[model samples]
Target: MLDQAQMRYFEGNYQACFELCLKGLEVVDENLKEKFVELAALSALKLEIPQALEFCAQSYHWHKNSYFWTLNLAKALIIQQNYAEAIKLLNAFMGVENPLKLEYLHALLRAYKGQNTYNEVENIYAILLKNNPNDLQLWLEFGEYFEFIPKKALGIYQDCYFFINQKLQALEKNTPKIEVLQTFAQDSLTARFNMQKTQKTLIENPEILNLKNFVNTILTQRIAESYLRIFESPLQEAQKAAQILYSVQDKNLQNAEFWFIFAHALEYIKDYAQAEQAYRYIFAIPNAPKNIANTAAFHLAYLLMRQERFKEGLEFYENRLAFAKNTTFSQEYYQIAKNAFLQDSKVFTNKEIFVYCEQGFGDTLMFSRVFEVLCKIAKKVLFAPQSALYPLFSAKLSKENCFANLEILDRIPQDFDFALPLTSLPLFLGLDTLEKIVTLKTPIISPTNKRKSRKIKRIGFFWHTDFALKENNTRNFSLEFFLNFLLELENVKLVSLQVGDFVLPECVENAGVGFKDWLDTYKVMENLDGVVGIDSSPAHLALICGIPTLVILQPRFDWRFGLYEAPKAKFYGENAHLFVSNPNDFSTKNTIIEKLKSIF
Candidate 1:
């Protein structure tokens, strides 16, 4: 019975082998228990069940080689999504070198992903790929990790294409030799080498053929995406990407991911009609990944929202709930957002509403304007702002109105009748529609009589913004760009709004006082004639204070700013000016300098 089970396992009949192993185990002696248990566990794993974990645990108890059994147990736990146990077991084996390290590392990759530990997943991928560049599954996993960032994924896929072709060429050249070497080997050692060589050839090894097909499919999808990264102009980028993709025969025909990228490129350029058709193409595909389909629907919703088709937009945005993985400040907030049961603004009459700040400080600053509107309707309003913005909110609102106490450590206050995130307020208030949004009041604050040296014609400049984002880093130009331009503008003093320590030429003066408090930052802006910077907290603060501001934008600017260059962003009021720079054109510097001179 045991011999039959071994034969079935070798023949790849996992279900038959699993049943036969169970029968073999029923009458197997103690000496043979470990072998039967390992086989049973492997078969159960192939069947995808908790039965593997039980059998692997039994194998671990009876096996002489503890490390092998522990590794198998970890693999079983990882398959079952019991990542904590898998992670613990993997960590135990991390420093200790063993022959099974490769298996341990791969299991660790899945465990990290299960725990949402993306940085570690990337780290492990880098290590694995460096050791074995021909590992197609490793490349696939790497590309999948960047699903949100398609351009990065495309780059990885291209690398995989290069590697796969190299491997295929090598395999093809060696195939004729493989058969001859196997038939004419002189001895057991020579025969063994020829057999290993045969197994490595693509013609003999079916796994390589399967991987080669997968690589071709991924390579086709990435061609369109890789082109989109060329940020010349919106229309130009989209057209270039589309044209390059269409040039490839059969590349665009049946590829869902290709259509998805092509649609986004069109969307970026505001070709709504073509973009919508491209998205619908992806949705029409019966075999498209659900997460990707939901994302397409999400983008379709965004298009409607951008076009001020509010009713249609809201429906699509809600459809994204099927895949929208929202991370809020708390589990309660996440649940509230996911459920979205009470999104109506009109429901909160004479009730205490707590509006917790979410996302970045720029978003919070932009949405803080809605607090006054909330105070008007709600019986009482509690403003729970980010730690950095707490001082700003306290100064803006009365002490009684602001809730500085962090409920993160304690229970969510049961006193509030309704709680909503700052970003969600626009949706609930029916302020998303263009007409309603146009009439929405711009927030203006009265100067607190705080001024820094009463500098009447001073222009505050900052080049450092959100360096953590790759896009934001591109927007941050050198200080030399400003210094070269400002050399002629002797009348206007340039005050650096950048917080970090750096040596600025005598041409520009640092603001000196670091903004430890929001009030200090407010006073500095109040004194300046205008603010000049990329998108940052200071820029947002300056706009809110009604300071004349000139914002330098990247070619692909943040969605808050319109896609194309305009004199101003209407929502932030007339004092704010926006200039979009073409990354390919160096002359944009002169244009920016001219705008800065005009604004100042």
Candidate 2:
């Protein structure tokens, strides 16, 4: 029993092992005290109990020579915010043979950070980085250290950047042999397979051509990381990182990691078309890593979703469930989404269907357009929307039932035989092509309070989006930047449609008697002559309301916004025009001003 308990502890069944250890402690032999103490401490730490420090202290006392006990004790101390004790414990290992490796060093770094010992932290970081130049954690720590001691780390940071740039240059030089490119073109496994079709399309597709140019020029991850650390704003840093990557050559198309990194960066910048191609390019190669292929397929599905290409997208999305481990979504939720499955909606005839809302508020609204179609097919339909969206959706979807609370996920209606996410509707309904999406009936949800206006054109603007999304930050601006341009316009009256963190300073005329629910927001949008904002909910709202909207796009705008000079936007309809901002080099202000100037 004791041996089994120890095995469970090593296997990371921490909570289960903790219970076993507690039960074992009552009857264990005297010689097993040290082992029990170590297991108890380790499990308690993993389970995050207050007794962890006490248990860890006892383990170290009983087994002083065991590095596991020492490291666990130090980690517990750090967790308990006992920086002094942790530093003291970590410092003791510094002089020992093969000391301060991996967890010990990681613990020591946390201790140093807790104690604000910048110099010692840098020394330790440098040591680990030198030992393992390719260690991502070490590189990330080095990058973080600059953020930690911004002013004092300037000279050191410059030297680090120079070294990293040189490393990137060397990595870039590792191009495939001439014959490899020839093989890729005609006889390589990828070229000989279905990828040959994609390769041929890429050669002629203008969108692919633009992306190929951008993808071929960017720097590697390490070089971009090193370069971006110089910028204070995370948004600017990501923008610069994307630009750096956009200028480098992917000389080694055969490199899997290289494609993954490049694809990831492209996604971050909202270059979905290119990102899709890059991800697909990875799978075309034989012997592609299972994990990478699955992840790429998952992201490719999302890229397609963003473009409203749901049928094929959901197929790929579902395919990724096998590899969907350690994600933010709960296991239960994952099982539900994974198990719900995709099929023709006609199969749900004479059946009850539960439609679940996934993703953000914007996504729910954008996809809710399909609920009416769903209700027409299923005999009984129950819709679960985000709590905040319930007020508007319930009002609009009153003919059909709607549940806002998440607790509904626990008991879903008793008779519902089929389930699907709101986003997956397009797929199951067979709305596969872009032409179908463009012609799909516009959603109708009447807003409660409509503004009665005069001759002056009502130009509405929303400046900020979710701050946590780093890519959205690139599209965001100081309200002042837009205000200055709008203030210069003589024929239009500016209205602030922005809410939450973005509504500060109250510079523009507030629309109506405040806003409530998506209905009120849409009503406000309905009265506008035009709307300007990033690729956020408000932009989607404006499109749904059939307002003339000019969407300000970052270099990597969402695929639904379509390419530059696209005749019509899939999501925003024919009334929308796009103005993509150049992040690293040019100003988007003049372009925006010109668009605003032409609006009247």
Candidate 3:
């Protein structure tokens, strides 16, 4: 039990360690009581429990001969704001003529600070820091001590910069840097803030005489970072930091850590051009850690890709390597593609090429038009598309359509020269520019489901995708959001192309329950005047069939939809309309409703 408690304490599980130590005290021997009391007190202090003072007092009382126990009790007294008792105990302990770590003297400084006694504080701190020049703990505590007093901390940071630089270098080169960064990335927040005046105040201060040189340069960066971490709330603090960084041009741009913070600030404010430039610069920095550089490289393309500049950004999309490890590559297929992925522009010319669909059915449908171009480039094309899409493609590309070389297959052949994803088609097809790629081919225009007689135009829409396809339901929504806009229109028949178990209003005719696969949905889509949906296969199929489809998306939508800036989809062409849904931006919803009214 004592061993378990000790292990928990060392592992930094303070609550668990404190609880285990309590249980241990009941069973431990007299000699072992000291360890129990020590772990319990230290863990309690970390947990910020009131019992920390009680346990610390007991530990100090029972272990009167120990140097560290005296310090622990003093720490508890300082935390409890018993400034006189803490000062008396610390001074007596210091008078014992025993050598101590710089961190131990910092406890005395803490006691002095509690009483607002600054007379000896600066002199003691400077002497200790000068003597213990290499003490990391002293430097960290010193930084923490004067957090709000940015000027004092800035002076110390400048004085002991060699030691600070060494510690930074060690942390930067740590083997676990990537894992650490990955962990920090799991939670993120956003808020609005402005820190321009802080810079103005720091510059204009008359008392900041000698500090002016550093303040205008490194000290400017230091002051901005100083009080940020004393939290007001996560979002507000995050904004304060980004806003603070925005006005901080004196920052060392060469530092990986500085670049990381600066780049994120640029992104938070939607200054994507500068953010992309910063990320690219970080990626090219030779001195930056590989993990940091790779992280910058990973997000470098998103700035452009998210803005619909895939032509310039596709080759730089390394996010697959950094975040979506499983989706990025499977060990089985990575083996083949790693060496032979689209070997040459004419690699498919008079040769057998294997094309597989790996992304969602919507992505497949969006990129499927390139397959016909693939057929034209190759003597024989071995296509392994989604099974649900097989019947539609096989029928569409039959001998009658003159696609005799294209073969839709259930199993990929072993003899194909090279393998590639359907999404990667443009890279090898020599459609090197975004313009050529978007216009690769028009969507499959089918003649079958066209309604000859049109009176009240029938419109089909679905607002959901397979739950597994979208994380956090970003691509799914309650059909009720659109019901107001959709149903309000005059001379329109609402048809639900939605599948699965869904509740629909009585006014909506449920056409989705009849669909077994995308082929069924495609057939149904042809009979409608148009379709509306989130980024799902049904909408992609509707758009591909050259039906006027309104793809309702969130502001930060799929790479295919581009952004709301231009509000045009060059690749999906004029038959397709993109509407990025933001609850605050009702103009888009109004536009979509007006577009629906015109169709009738």
In order of TM-score, best first, we have 2, 1, 3
Per-residue accuracy of model 1 over 1-600 as CA lDDT, tens digit each: 778888988898999999988887788687777677889998887787789999988877776357778888888898889999989987787787777888888889889988988789878988899999867777877987875566667677778888777877777666523322223345567557655433332235554565555654556546556556545455575676666555552644677777777777777666778888888888888889887888888778766665557667766765544543344455465456435445553676666777775567777777666555566566776666766666665565433332222122112456676677766666665565655554444333545432334444688888765553554214665566555565556467778888776789776767745777666677677677777877777888888777888887666555456434332474577778987655445566667777776776
Q: Which candidate leads the pack in lDDT?
A: 1
lDDT for each residue of candidate 2 in 1-600, tens digit (9 for 90 to 100):
578888888888988888888777888677776677778888899887877998999978877987777888888998898988888887787677744466677788888888888787887787777777645445545755675344334444445545555655554455211222223556567767666623322123343333333334322445555433333444455566567656563564665656666675666555767878888898987888888888778777867766667677777875544543443123464345445443342576656777766566777767766655665666766766766566555445433232221122323456556666666667666667665655654334533333335567888888677642554324665576666566767667788887765444454787633776666776566677888877778877677766777876654455465442342366546667777654343355666778876754
Count of steric clashes across candidates, in order:
0, 8, 0
Better of 2 and 3 by lDDT: 3
Q: Which stretches of candidate 1 lie over 4 Å from their true place?
A: 1-216, 230-237, 244-259, 279-298, 314-345, 398-414, 442-444, 448-456, 467-475, 565-568, 583-585
Q: After superposition, how far is residue 532 of candidate 1 from its true place, in Å?
A: 1.0
Q: All candidates' lDDT scores?
A: 0.68, 0.64, 0.66
Compute the lDDT of residue 512 as modeled in candidate 2: 34
Per-residue lDDT value at 278 in model 3: 73
- 104 in model 3: Cα distance from truth in Å? 31
lDDT of 3 by residue, 55-127 (tens): 9999889888677778888889888999789778777767666665454678878778888776567767777
Per-candidate alpha-carbon RMSD to the true structure: 12.1, 11.9, 16.6
Q: What TM-score number comes out for model 3?
A: 0.55
List of clashing residue pairs for candidate 1: none
Error of 3 at 120 (Å): 46
